[model samples]
Target chain A: MHSKKVRIITVFAAFTCLLWIFGLGWTVKDYLIGAAHSAYSPPAADESAAQTNELKIIALGDSLTRGTGDIEGKGYVGYVTDQLKKEGLDVSLINLGIKGLTSERLAEQIKEKEIKRQIGQGDIILMTIGGNDLFLGGQTLTNITDDSISKLEEAYLSHLKAILADIRAVNTEATIYLLGLYDPFNEFPEGALTSKTVRGWNSKTMELLAEDSKAVFVPTYDLFQLNVNDYLFTDHFHPNEVGYRLMADRVAALITSGGGPR
Target chain B: MINLVQNEMTKLLGKRRFIIISVIILVLLSMFTYAQARQAETIKERLGTVDWRTELQQKIVDWQNRLSSAGQWREQLQIQIEQSQYYLDHDINPSEPGAPTFIRGFVENSAELFLPLLIMIIAVDLVSSERSMGTIKLLLTRPVSRFHILLSKYIALILSVSLVIFIFGLLSYIISAFMFGNQGWAAPVLTGFKVEGGELNISEVRLVSQWQYIIQQFGLAWFISLVVGTLSFMLSILMRSSAAGMGTMLACLIAGAILSNMVSSWTSAKYLFMVNLGLMNYVSGTAPPIEGMTLGFSLAVLAAWMLGSLVVSFAVFMRKDIY
Candidate 1:
């Protein structure tokens, strides 16, 4: 009986090792073949979609650009694309937004070759910056002095000018829409100060956009100005689906009203 | 004492159970390798025509942009970009798909869970099966002391644990190296990733050669297996049946893995023996299942449990009469 069990054990061990050898050999062979080939290439534009007047929308800037705080994971970018589709326009969006992105980082990002290339390829560019600068990178909203907001506004304007210049350098045709900030702490004690700071920043952004014909400052303060809680996500920073949908509607309206090439 | 250990070793080697368990682990590991390689193939297909250098640069920019924005997962993304930037600056491509570095990554990933379970299968039956087969009387009647006999069995258990781990590392290296080519051992890898107060503590991070990383990883894996093997060994001695020992040990291990994720905020969960088993997470610089679990704290907990089990195991075996 001991001998029989030993024989069974030996066979089982040998069989398993054989399976190991075979499986590993096959996988490694596949890996080798794969490593020799080109890993990825840009997708070719579909002729049918192009015939339907496909619009390439490049969304850039902060977490609002990346669509965080929404359980659906579809930030304003998704809603904008969906609304465009509803209007019988074929749309392809390239979102290059990062979380915690400041105006300075977005300025630097526009200089990257791939991002430059992506921006050049777009018919429209959507941006949400300066939120981090004023909010202090989502740290706190209660501590606000007019002096700090002015300093931030100065830095943000220079960065925004540089960003627009860089985008124009790459592609002069894409319409740039910089979204204005909403007062998330509308119910807080210093909410009034925050509202004043945001409006000051938006007016400055609008003044900068006036210099460029294709650049327009899209306002979002009115949408959440009254019912801030309903529009704001649970984080009290980013917009919920309802908020994103409102922004998307404004963007779609801009596009329909000569925001881009017809 | 040496002869008794030799006898124990032979008894272990001669059994079909040990071989069967080893084979099962081998099969599972190979399947994992196969799936990993398949995934690499699709990634390779997706990366068509883009130079890896350009891709790496693009990834760095993406990480930078992510870090600069106010959003969730900032710390984790920052660490990844830093690691990638290190590789970029050094001109070492650690992201080579299907490479040995990639395969070695899976070892550390699986070591915390799969490796320990494999070692448990060999250990849970060591003493209980002997008692169940009525062979304890025959062994105890010999001139050797009961302590020597149990000690020999324990040594044999350790030897088997070493063998299984050796096979796991060896087979993975041989098969992956053969396919991916024998490269990347000298490549530098970033280590010492740590978190504190729900934020990444960057001060602890460092860079080490891939070879050193592999050695430290295996050492940590072996240490974890020792704790697991010894715990199951104690259980095998206490329980009268091998099935009961194996079942209880398995349940405890699974529960510990699950509870580590769910009740990590529960301060007392840190004291559980299985909670301390993921010591590799600390060495690898990933977030621990629970916050504030340092390497020293886990090691001390494991050592105390090991010593306690050893004392209990010996006390019971020496006093209890053979059936």
Candidate 2:
């Protein structure tokens, strides 16, 4: 019995040593191979689900779409997604919004391959742009000027047109909803100048949309025009949670009513 | 010498130490697996209808922002960005909860801390217990030179350390795979980010299979465990009391872990063996506790300490009287 126990113990230790050596060998071999194997292409997505998703929302633009100001980290896009799910629609969202993306940068991003692929697969697309352009890209409010605003608006219009063209190039069937920017400086001393400039930008955006039957410009200027202080984030520029919800409610109503096809 | 080693190995193997350590490792692994499962569930619930692409993008940007302000965490954030970018670029969805990748992640994270502690537990009393138990005289009276006896014990300690780490890795993989699944070994992992002049140079990032990553991580982890075990072995020889040896080593290790984070600016702290023990961080492209501490530098520091310890231990064992 004593010898038998010793034999069993010997075998166990030997077996463990073998495994340890084996594991070490395997890792050493892999480390060498890994050094040589540098390029990696990720596996493809599930084909069946990828092709037949019921609803897909692709959002692009600046911090509002990125949910920067909202304490919950859920911008208008989150509210829209929740409302869509509540209404029993299967929703999958692709949001590609950088924090400080101007209209020009966004136009460039729209041409990128990843964004193009997402736009191609989207059933409903949403966007918010030109805020950084007209607001001097988060500069001090005193830096605003009527003449500079007009100059920024002209450049922003061409970029927004190019952006729309890029989206339409890849995706002709998706319902394109471009969200209009609101004036967070509506209660400030320069409120009138900013609102007027934002309205001019909106009018130009709406005119561009008029040329395309599938694209609709969702207006949010009126949404925050009254409760500007309440809707404004602590930064006094971006929209707070209540402001995003208001934007979401408007977009949700539009989608439920007629935007998303039955 | 070989016979002496074999005898020591037999004695070490026969002890209840192996059983206790294995049980402890198994219990901890199960707890980790359970917690991981719960976390995956919560993430799934929280994600709801958000697509993986948006989530990955958000995570990437968030890490980038964090990287800008956090000098200590740049390596981690850089790796996160690289991984997320790969997922986005290749159109591969981020890993689901309770997947093999998650298990691999857990193994990588715990190896540098838990694996070493387990090895320390077994090594702390290697020589001290024999002396305290009055077996040192019997050990000394043997025909073999005292050096052979001490060398045998040291070799046995190393073998046991390797065995424990092996068991921990294998058992962790098995248990986590059971909870999660055995898929995703083919998943691509990013590596090769290195720090140059205090800034991470992510230009050489490479993608290797998940299996490759686990194997490499295990190898590095084994090296770390070996270093830790040898340090404790020397302590056990010098202190002549298991508790004191183990306590001192543990305090130094814990203090090193803390000081590495808080005292990166203090140049003298760089020479601490504990500060240099995070060798895996260097292997994985994370910066060391102190600036300019490269993988080669840390390896050299550890090797010197290890060599110094072996010299001290052998000198003390050969000359000291067995009372």
Candidate 3:
């Protein structure tokens, strides 16, 4: 009986061994085949730029641009797109926002091999970025450049420029509207130091707008600043329904005016 | 006495159970490690292909911009963006999931579900079996006293239970190393991930060493299993019939385990032996469960219960009218 039990145990052990071996081998093969396929046929960017349309818009940068955390939590993209439809404007927003992305991260995404092929001439590029970078004390330099509030601002802009250059590399004739960083700090009445950093950041944003008139600067600073208590939420940051509506109105007015492609 | 335990240990050193359990663990570890290695290699192959993060973020923001923002709510999104930004700045992706968490160690984690049955198989009929065959009465009639006979069997039971726990833990340790890699040995465990509104929040804490972690994890399982085995041994003595003892203990063990998860709201249920099954964590330096009976408290409760059963067994075995 003991010998019989031993034989049974041994068989069970051998069977388990065989199962693991074949299963491991299969896993390796699946990964190898997937790797080979990706290499053999690289995923290319979409070539159809919707040339039949009178206007083409690309929404770029982080979650805010992605329009995920709005009041409906569907975000600003659908609302803005629907509002655009309200006035017969041929438009489509090419969404390219990566969550947990700073300006540098966005720059990295912009340089993706597939995205380069998709951006085209005469496209309208709308972007909301740099808020994440600024909030994280993204200041790379210890000394503030009068040109920028903190030395890191210099580094941050270079990253932004790299992102811009990447887009321009693909579509030079596209009109890019850079939304100036709003005073999310305005709600923080007691946060004088943080507000200074916010003021300094906003200053640099305006200066960049002056530098490129062809690039329209949509001022969101005032939209979120007024009735700061009423517009702000319990978190004392971001926008409520009133604030998002103001944002939609600002963007709609610009596109309705047919802001020319720079 | 220690040497006797050690000698019994050597008897099990090359036993089939030891060899079989170890190899099973090693093979599992190797397979998981190899698969992960291959998958990571593929990810590296297409490292520069797609910027999934930006694409995801863009989707979030497009949704953010379109939705009609309501009252005092924008502040929360601001915090989300800021918190999301922190992860971005650090290049950390907390959402990437794999492997059971550290507290829930591989071997012992499954042990709760299956280890109890294995223990019952070996230990249920331990003392009762000798009596069932009338061999125990023959031994008692010999020159040796009843205490010595009982003590020997008890020691043997302890040794066997310890070996099983060690083997179970050893298998998990070696296998996880293969599945997760050496890096995973040091991989951060989000001990208790806090999820709100379908989002996982990462808190600040240092990672514990893998080996030390395994020791603590095994320690907990052994303690719990020891409690379980001890209870079965006590039951084995009280009941003259091995089948009766094993069946009753098995039902109680199963019922205890099932009740802990199902009727969690019952405050009185905390005293149940099954609820204290996580005695593994107690010995390993973790905080007690919500309003849990403490380690000292639980050990005392189990000890009293065991001592009480042993008292009843000694009295009945020494003087009971057995046919």
Candidate 4:
């Protein structure tokens, strides 16, 4: 019979061996699953390579890219892809939009060791941000006087400029289409201060885009406001599936039109 | 002193009791080994025969396309691809003279889940079984000092538990190796898997022999099991009934597991035993629970708990009236 202390210690050792070192194939499985949860699980190797590059566009944004407000979750990204394919454009679309990410965060992700390979030179980049800036700052963003407006605008534009810089850095020849903020406040009944700031931010976005020849500004401001209640997700702010489809379709059109200066 | 301990143990583990327990331990170990083998079979079926070379290529392709696809995971896809490519490029598959895939599996699975359960089963009744049978009185009547007797019984129980566990380990290793052979002891390891803020990453991925992994796992499991065993044994002494001690400790163990699962949101619960069960997570470099606690924290918590239990157990044992 084993001494109780020694027996206990042995049990500990044995259990340790079992959990920590037992045939480790299981650990690999755990690792794989964990990796899959956050990272992309690429298509099976057997997947046929793209037949042609009629146009391979990856939409990178947040809820809008995800079709959050849409009934079917087919945000504009899907719509644009469908429209382009219908138009005989060979297009492959990848949507890498995480909810609740600010432009700062999205840029950080772009700089990751991982995103480098996903973006391609000559590929079109469709990006939508500023929703979170509105969500987090809300009415507080509107309180800026002319004196502070310039200061705040400088800060906001600097961040956007940094993000745009990253997109170019990652994909040098890529055309970056930055979607301005939609007017979710149009349907905001009576008067909400946050709604006014949403409009101000949209103007700011357009103003910022005017300085750059390459950064095309897609005006989603007028579109979502037309059917604020129906096109928006239940949250009443982010575009619903239909709204996203519209956004995606708009960007797809711009990608094809090769939009000239307004 | 020896007489008291012998009398206590003789009555506690009556000839029939001794045989039954020994059989039970052996049977449990055997069943556990059988189950482990079955688990390996299941993995083999799903993952396709454990050929790491093929698996690596498959992973690389999968990772490459994942980055190419858009689900807002483009960045992560890049990282995952690079890591997989690193392994494949270096030719460090699991079969390439390293810890077999199972040892890698053990490292992932060892934290907080299996180790505690084993300790719970083995040590919860180390003292209470005798007390529950009301044999403490008879033993106390002998001239042997209670402390001496308790110490000897403790030694014996520890020995039995250790042998049972070692055999359990050996049986599992043999059963798995029967199917895996050198695959059991050699395979490359990838330990950088992380899920923070819903983000994932991986690194290191060096090759270590499965045997070495087993040894490492053995050391880890021993430390964890010791913590659990000490705490449960103390509980057994305080409760004086096998069922009560076992039931309480089992509940506690289960609670720890459940708490660990949900504590990511609760955050503060990380200080509790439930969140600490998978203390190995810290060592494995998964983010610590509650944003800060490490393996060291969990160890300290277990140590404190054990020390507290010991104080209570000793105080009660040293002073309680035998009658």
Using lDDT as the measure, the top candidate is 2
Which stretch of 10 consecutive residues in model 3 chain A shows the poorest summed lDDT?
A: A33-42
Candidate 3 residues A50-138, lDDT tens each? 34544656667765665433577434544566677678765555566654458887887676544555455336788888877776543
TM-score of chain A of each: 0.79, 0.81, 0.72, 0.70
DockQ for each numbered candidate: 0.07, 0.31, 0.04, 0.05
TM of chain B vs. native, candidate 1: 0.88
**Clash pairs (backbone) in predicted model 2:** none
Over A8-28, each residue of candidate 4 has an lDDT whose tens digit, in order, gives 444454454455434233433
lDDT of candidate 4 at residue B200, scale 0 to 100: 43
Residue B178 local lDDT, model 1: 61
| TM-score against truth, every candidate | 0.65, 0.86, 0.44, 0.56
Compose the digit string of candidate 1's lDDT tens values, residues A39-135: 2222342212223356878888888987887668778877888788788876766677888888998898788655676676678999999888888
DockQ ranking of the models: 2, 1, 4, 3
Residue A76 local lDDT, model 3: 53
| Residue B314 Cα positional deviation in candidate 4, in Å, after optimal superposition | 7.8
Q: What's the CA RMSD for each of the models?
A: 9.3, 3.7, 14.6, 11.0
Residue-wise C-alpha lDDT for candidate 2, range B1-323, written one tens digit per residue: 76676777777766778788889988988898888778656644553333566556656655644564667577656755765675577676556433557656665676667777888888888888899999888988878898889998987777787678667767777897798877888766666666666566766677666676666666667767777888899999889889899889889888877888887679888888888877667546666677788666766787788888899989998998889
DockQ of 2: 0.31
Interface RMSD of 2: 4.4
Q: Which ten residues in a row have the lowest lDDT in candidate 4 chain A?
A: A40-49
Residue A16 in candidate 4 has what lDDT?
42
> For each candidate, what is the lDDT?
0.73, 0.76, 0.55, 0.58
Over B1-323, each residue of candidate 1 has an lDDT whose tens digit, in order, gives 75676676668777755567657756876777678678656544433222454457546756765565636456567666765655555455655544457556766776667887888888988889898898888999999888988998887777676667667777777767766677777665655556576555655445556766666666667677778889899999999988898888888888978887676569888888888887666665656667788777787798899889989989999998888
Global lDDT of model 2? 0.76
